[model samples]
Target: MVSITSTASLANALRKTIVDTQNQMSKAQVEVSTGRVADLGLALGGGTAQDVSLGVRSADLSSITNSNAVIAARLSTTDTSLETIATTAQNFLETLVGAQSGAGSDAQAIQDNAVSGLKSLIGALDTSIGGVYLFGGVSTSTSPIADYFSDPPSASKDALDQAFVSAFGVTQSDDAVGSITQSQMQSYLEGGFSDLFSASGWTTSWSSASDRATSNRISLSQIADTSVSANDSAFRGIAAAYAMVADSGVTKLGSDAYNEVLRTATTTLSSAIGDLTRLRASVGVMQTNVSNANDSLTAQQNALASQIGALENVDPYEASTRLNNLTTQLETSYTLTGKIQQLTLTKYI
Candidate 1:
């Protein structure tokens, strides 16, 4: 052995190298946990811009997920409101059918039931979800139907028209006059109202509005408003006939009068039921669409979570293996450095 005094110096240098290796190992552990190679530019010496861009993209996806959650809640609320309207409309039709067929002594009672049913139906149309009217035209500020007499007599065409116009908006033009049925008019009105708030484009959702594209504006708030002027006109005619039959001058309603009332009621009720059925079908489609959208969103979110994890999360097994290899290399380097220092000519001499 040379017995070199430089052994201490070599040992000191080797110890320093070991300390530096240990520090690097510690830093690697931090990188694995955080899913980021700290000081990528300094350590890896490249890709600074790409790292920054990926960070921004991850943040944006997180924001989109939050927005979708809000939209789903509002859509659920609207769907519930639609179900209520459908049920109420169905009940009203049944009650009207019974009233028309009942005895003469129960005329007032039957009329009262009809008025109550009308009120309930009107109430259903005018109800709102999240402050957005279910039936009112673009304006959620007012009721869709008002000014109807509940007792003794039927309401006027003008009153019905006004209500329809309020509920449907400018879509119920002057030309859509006397030719329309109440059922058609109601459908037109409801459809127009609903159309104003229909879903326009592809987006997760918005509460007040949603735009999947820049140019598309689907209104999810408005109900469809079809022409119900004929139904309205028919009801007016029935009320007039009923008034004649009730008057002292008319001992009884002739077969013609009875057939006309029954015909008008049946026709109006059938049309109304058709309109409601179509609406129900539309709601079913919308519910399915919403459910599909929710499922898709959930799947996307899960996929995104996995992607984020792949990008950022560290595998403990792999990290531990790498750490062990680096430790072994550092130990071997120190051992070799010691052996190099011990080799000398002194012991041979």
Candidate 2:
């Protein structure tokens, strides 16, 4: 009981076979040229889920890497600003020591240098980069310190002026100012002068910058604090030293009162230098954390990329060989279809 197949049915079946082989050849050629699978789902089949997961993970890691890069840049700027401040404090100390040692007898000249140094230190504390204040803590949009030389005079200057007037009841030029004792001057520094550097004084005199420091997510689980604020002890110490020298007035430079002020300033400046050095070391640790996180992310990204490549990437040589085989199969199918079509029922009878 052999069932005879219809010629039209056989022809239709051959045509479908030819179409399927042509599609395979086309896909192989594309893979050969692009070196990547045209369809991840089709190429990876059941393993597509793993490929998708890797893709998402890679994207997350890349974003973290970029964020860390920005943090690194900000930390670098902060480090530079702190270094500048430290250097300024060191130089001011040298100037103060030189004056106290009486190496140069021109009191007026020493006063001028002190004034200049104070202005420079203020400028450094107020440093900004890319429209963001490095020492402003979380208040990146505003300068952290006011210019001491502004036309109207900053609140810090006005406060010092009042303190001087109250202390001696006369200006620095009065001979009575020369009679002020060292202990009295020290009292002013530890009391009023020190007050000017206090948090309350800063709020009144300095710009209203935040006391909260900036931080960054350097890793998946870690957030690193990356900035030192202008409210830090080192900054306060330097500012107090400079303010004492600058606000004490020119007439008082050669007096016993001025020498006592200089001595206090030198001690404060020396302490500030040590504080800044320690702060810089802390910033260095932050820098290292960021760098290490960057490296770790990069390594993870590379590993994920390799996994995706294994699932989606095509071997060019293998694709080329497969394409040639499909091409031969397609040509043979066409030849056989032609031969079968020629064998009509009439020609066979």
Candidate 3:
């Protein structure tokens, strides 16, 4: 038995073939122009799993890179502020040494410079970057140090005033403080002055910042401390030393008493410089670590990008060639479809 085919059925089949060929040509043109598969699911089919895995890894690495950038910026700001404080401390130390050597023997002038240096140190420790206080430890929003020039003076300044009266039975600038024994002054320095730098004293007198350090996530599994607080021993020592010199009672004391205070201040300042230098070195090490991690992440990101491109990206040259072939086929199919539509039963008979 022979099978019979209808002209209408043949025409319908030709029309469907033309539509399918035109769709293929359109998709090929898109691939040629864009240099990427128009549909990943349709293009790669089962091979899309690798692309998905690589994309997830790339996104994770990118997130780590962004975190590293933010940490690096914050550390940079911290380093800068620490550097400024170190420079100021060194200059003030020189001034104290000069005073000790009688290079600028005016006690009042030395006292004034010490006062100014103390103010500068406070300002530096309270420095902020992007509305976040760099020296506030975990308390980013709070200023770390109290303002010494506030209406009633800061608690730290008030403590010094009270200590002066208790030790010498006179106000800071009164002539009676000049008559106090060197032994009494030394006692005050070793006992009372030392207390102001202690952890408890710092809380009561100088700072309200957190004792906890701020930390940042720099990598997939690593966290790093990102800031130093005003309560650091180095900062406390600097403040203490300067506060001694800046005290009105110390300045009004006789030359012997004033020199005693300067000597104590000089020793504390020297220790502070050493501590701050070490801290800056540590910050430098952290910076190097973050930079190295970023470099590694960049390399990984590049490799992942290449892997994704191999899986999903179209080759322009190959796609363009295929597009031209499809275009020719589509033209032929259109001509064939038109001829099929014009077919008649008389012609077929």
- Model number with the top lDDT: 3
Error of 1 at 232 (Å): 14
Q: What local distance difference test score does each model get? A: 0.46, 0.80, 0.84
lDDT of 1 by residue, 1-349 (tens): 6765676677788888888888878867776677655446674445555555655665554554464454345446545654665465456456546646663424444344445554554455456556655444344444444434435333333333344466434222344333444454335434532232123210011022111111111122222221111112222222222221222111122333333433444455556556655655654655455455546545655765665454455667777777787789798978878796787779789
Which segments of candidate 2 are over 4 A away from where they belong?
1-34, 170-179, 322-349
lDDT of 2 by residue, 63-136 (tens): 88988878888888778877777777787788889878986636667667678877777777677777888788
Give the best candidate by TM-score. Answer: 3
- The order by descending lDDT is 3, 2, 1
Ranking by TM-score: 3, 2, 1
Q: Each prediction's TM-score against the native?
A: 0.47, 0.81, 0.87
The Cα error of candidate 3 at residue 202, in Å, is: 1.2
Is candidate 1 or 2 superior in lDDT?
Answer: 2
Roughly what TM-score does model 1 have, to 2 decimal places?
0.47
- 273 Cα displacement, candidate 2 (Å): 0.9
lDDT of 1: 0.46
Query: Which parts of model 1 have CA positions greater than 4 angstroms off?
Result: 1-75, 103-105, 136-263, 316-349
Instruction: Assess the local accuracy of residue 153 in candidate 3 as a C-alpha lDDT between 0 and 100.
Output: 77
At residue 159, candidate 2 shows an lDDT of 78
